[model samples]
Target: MLKKSDYRVVRALGHGSFGSVFQITEIASGKQLVWKRMTIVNDEDRKMALSEAEILQNNKSDYLVEYYGQFEDESEFYILMEYCEKGDLRKYINHLRELKAITSEDMLLDIFAQLTEAIFSLHSANIIHRDLKPENVFMTDNFIIKLGDLGMARVIMGTQQHLSRIGGTIQYFPPELLIQIEESEIAKTDLRPQEPVIQTKQCDMFSLGVIIYELITLKHPFADQNGEVLRTNIIKCKPNPLPNNTPESLKQLIMQLLCKDPTQRPSIQKNKKEKHQKKNKIKNQKKKNKKEKNQKKNKKEKHQKNKKEKHQKKNKKEKNKKNKKEKQQKKNKVKNQQKKNNNEKHQKKNKKEKHQKLNKEEKNQKKNKKEKHQKKNQKEKQQKKKNNKGKHQKKNKKEKQQKNKKEKHQKKKKKEKNQKNKNGKQQKKNKVKNQKKNNNKEKHQKKEEEEEKKEDEKKEEEEKKEKKKDHKDKKEDKDKKEDKDKKDKHHKEKGKDESSEEDKKGQVQHDKNKEKKEHHKEKDGKGEEKKEEKDKDEHHKDKKKEEKKKDKKHEDDKDKGKKDHHKKEEDKKDHHKKDEDKKDHHKKEEGEKKVETEKKEDKKEDKKEDKKEHHKKDEEKKEEEKKKDHSKKEEEKKDEKKKDHKDKKEDKKEEEKKDHSKKDEKKDHKDKKDKDEKKEEGEKKDDKKDHHKKDEKKEKEDKKGKKKEKGDDSDKGEEKSPNVVQAQDIKGDA
Candidate 1:
């Protein structure tokens, strides 16, 4: 029987209106097969497909088809059967049409016989295959005809039923089915079944007649496409007549099948004997094929099973040998590990003991050596102190002797300085006495010079009176000469009053000559007056020169006195510098003597420091011994724990492990807080330090400024003091 799962699809065979057919392989035998899958979309369609599957399942005709199984799913119904390489009768007709092959009557008879057998089987089962066309009439690759696809086949068991349903290819539908369809449609709207649609198994016979017509004439019996034309043609029972070359007997059979009258239409030709023989032969042949295929499969399966069993046995033995060798190797490894562990533990124990003993011996030896060294150092310190005392006494005696000698020398130098001061005071008094005498002499000389100037002035006045008398006489002479010249010019002009133009010009020229002579006489009188004034100025300038000489002599005397005073002061300063230099030399000798004493003290201190360092070294040596003991004990215990132990290592690591991230988080938080605090504190401290430093700097600058001021004042001496004290006087002067 056909089933959805029974065949795997290979390729599409063909398709029709409602569903498609595919060439598939039967799953069980891997043989090529075909499945007629109808798309059954509703309950009615499913019911119809289910009924068809049942009908095909009930059929016992080899000539009908090889119905393997029937299957169905949500959307489709499938009927699995043998694959016909040549396809169905419709395809064969088309193939023949394409080739224009002349089909024989015998081939038609053969198909008719196969179809008759198929219909006979369906009828025996009380089923009517309402739709029968060339497409439904399939053939095998071997040219074996098979009638299949009972999708429209109906159950008509008891009476000739009235079916108003209309489905199937319209071109293949007989006239009777079309007529019933019309009546059924009419009956539906009219709401009556009074005149029943008389449908029966004979409708299938009519469809068969249509297929026969197509095979013979290469055309549909109705000679119209699937439309109203085909329906009307089918209803009118107007099929084209048979061809001229058609066997009359087959034609008559076809005519009988297509008769318009249902009662007149022929039933499917049935031959029980031939069907039995064919059925039996088909059954035996299938049994033989099945038996041969099973034998080949069983033989191949047995061979594979034997091979698998041998492989499994060989693997089991090898696995067992491998397991034994691995077990031995593991035993040896464990034993070696145990031995190594024991040896390591023993070695660690010995090492710990050796280290402890060695540390103790070294500590005792160091203590003994330190005690002996300390005693020796103490004796040396005592001897050094005695020797230092002797040297100190000797140095004190020498210092006292040097001090006496320095004192005597200082007293002698003081006597000489006092004597020098007395002499300098006597010299200053004598110089002052002489300057007073010189100033008195200058006063007397200036008095005498002033008296002489008065005498010279009296003498000059007398000389001026004599000169003035001479000048008066010269002026009188000049006055007389001028009067004479003017009278002469008056006479000349009076005489020329009546003269001619040339005579008048000669009179003017003579008057000009008289005027020139008077002007020369007047100039000579002025020259004599100027000479008298020049003689008076010469007497005044001579007195001025005498006064300038007296002033220069006084300034020269004052400058000489200032120079003498400066030279005396310079001599006193040089004597003082010499005395200071002698005192500095004595001080340097004392400082050198003090440095020698300090060097002796530093040597004693160095010896004391060495003793202290030696004692500290002894103490450090003792500490090292203690630490070594502690470390050795710790190592011994640690090694014991490590020896022959794997679990302890993990346990210790887990115990020692800490959440570093949490620690880091805490540390970071602490660090941040510390940094903030430090930054704040540092800022405050830095501020304080900066202020303190600034104050210190100011104090230092003040001290430096004061020192610089003092030094500058000393360098300028009374120069600055005079400027400051006399500032009021300077401002008044400005």
Candidate 2:
């Protein structure tokens, strides 16, 4: 739950489209840290931002900037990182350039060593910093190089050639990457470059060489040209020669690093091994020099000791002879000195008394002088204090005058600021008035547009209604003609049958009854079909009416919403009232829609039930017709058998006819059953097709919703990395 308000911003370090970086101090801890705030819009951006933090956290190098922690809110991701007070290498180089100074050879070597060590650490972790430049290399107070800004870094698995988009500073690009730049230019500008550049650890080494060359020369090795020419030079030409003062070894090393082919460039691992060997060789040479100097010193000391010993022996012999002569002379002097000592003691006593009297006199004189000096010192102190008091008074008066001037100046500034603020407020008020007038005009225009749309919709609805009515009238006319044709055919058939069956009146009457029954059944079936069609039409009409009502309600609601919004803007005092009214209106509309849908469903169910009942009645009529025909035939057979009293062959023929008639009846029943089964199967297939269509629509809608959600997640764009100054060796995870 780390909030932006928790830390006080000192100043903005950088700003870009992705987010901003700030130098901030935690209020509670009072520690100054760099706060990198990234605005992440999608999952990919979020992963990239988090990878930087992860790299900083996992990498442990003395030359890498430390990662503190990270936190995020809904849309913004934050990273707290160590603040490098001395800034970056680019700034340091620029500072040296400003001073017209170049880095010493030893210092340059030291920087190069640290950079190699950082790159070695990253390479060991299989990470390649594709954007290595002086700007991305940070420095500490003690000039320790910290490699950072891994925004374009990628991780490669073993032996995998990374295919990458060409980015980073082109001047530092190796020859292999630079060669692709020309192909991109020849390509259409509208299309993205198709050629892929292979990025590897050697790219970082080449960039390191460029940074070193720039550090020494205070310019790019491929400098003195635009980007295009520089890239071409990097690819097809050589870097400018190092200065004459540059050591042969360093010159050779830089040249090797700037090799056109990446394979020719020295690897960081090889450089590290060579550095260790050089250190050991230097140590051994220092030991040999110390041994040689110690041997020379020992030889000189021995030679000096031999000379001193010989000279000391000669001096000792001469001193011994002189001591013997002095001993005899000292004995004679001691005898005379005993007598002189007694005489000298009396004279010494007299002198001592005179000296004591003089010393007392001088002490009195000194006391008188000390008293005079005290009085003079007191007068001088009084005069100095008086002068100091006047000086203090003058100082206070000057300070008061300065304070008064400052107050007056501040007052004038305040007055001017207030006047400016008043003018600004008046301008804002005028702008608001103008905005209100524009809004009013826009609202009027919107109302007119809506009216026109509504009118067009009304016309379309009317046209649809007319078309439906014409279609219904046409269908009715066709049904009438079909009914008239059926009647005419029935009458003609009745006349023809009457003429053919004049003698067999009973049989004809029976046939006529059967025909009448069949005609009536046909009429009933047609009537049922017409009723079913009418019901279907009514159901369709109800659905259309419901749809039109819902549409109109939606339009009305939209118009009301616009009017309410306008009212709220014009009359802010009644905002709450209008909101309540709007809520009520929406609820009312929703309830009405729901009720209408329920009624439509009920009507559909009624139509289904009616069709089912009609089917059951038709089946019942068919069964009754079959029973009546069978009973009529059975009675006719009984009367024939009773009246004939004829041959066995006649009876046998009658039986055969009865059996054939039964077989025909059975065939007819089976055909009817098959037709009913087929009709049921067709209806089932139609229902299944409708269900499938609905499911497909639902799936499409779901896909659209998901797409919309992803679209909403795609925010403005990612941030441009300035100088992250955070380690990135192991975090790309590629």
Best by TM-score: 1
Which pairs of residues clash in candidate 1, taking residues 3 or more apart in a chain or in different chains? 1-68, 1-69, 1-70, 2-69, 2-70, 2-71, 2-80
- Lowest lDDT sum, 10 consecutive residues, model 2, at 717-726
- Candidate 1 is scored at a TM of 0.38
Instruction: State each candidate's clash count.
Output: 7, 1
lDDT for each residue of candidate 1 in 1-734, tens digit (9 for 90 to 100): 44466667889977665567888876665677777778877788777667766766777577676777766676777777666667778788888989998689777776777678778777777777766777778776556677777776677758765365565565565676565554322211212223535568777778788787878888767654432334466677557888899888888989888888878988765477987786675568657766886888788667767877998999999999999999999978985775464454245444664686579769866975896588569757865875686578557756865785587579758966986898799789989999997786667546545744664575577447535743663575456567787765554454233222422343343334324333332333434345335434654564464345335433534534465457446755864675476557656755886898899899879978986996797679658856865786586557546642654564465445435534764786588557644543443454465467557655655666758877566547634644564454334322
Please report how far candidate 1 places residue 223 from its true position, in Å.
Answer: 1.2
Quote each prediction's TM-score: 0.38, 0.36
lDDT of 2 by residue, 541-589 (tens): 6448545643543453453446434643554454346547655765676
Candidate models: Cα lDDT each: 0.65, 0.67
Cα deviation of 660, candidate 2, in Å: 99
Q: What's the distance in Å from true for residue 478, model 2?
A: 99
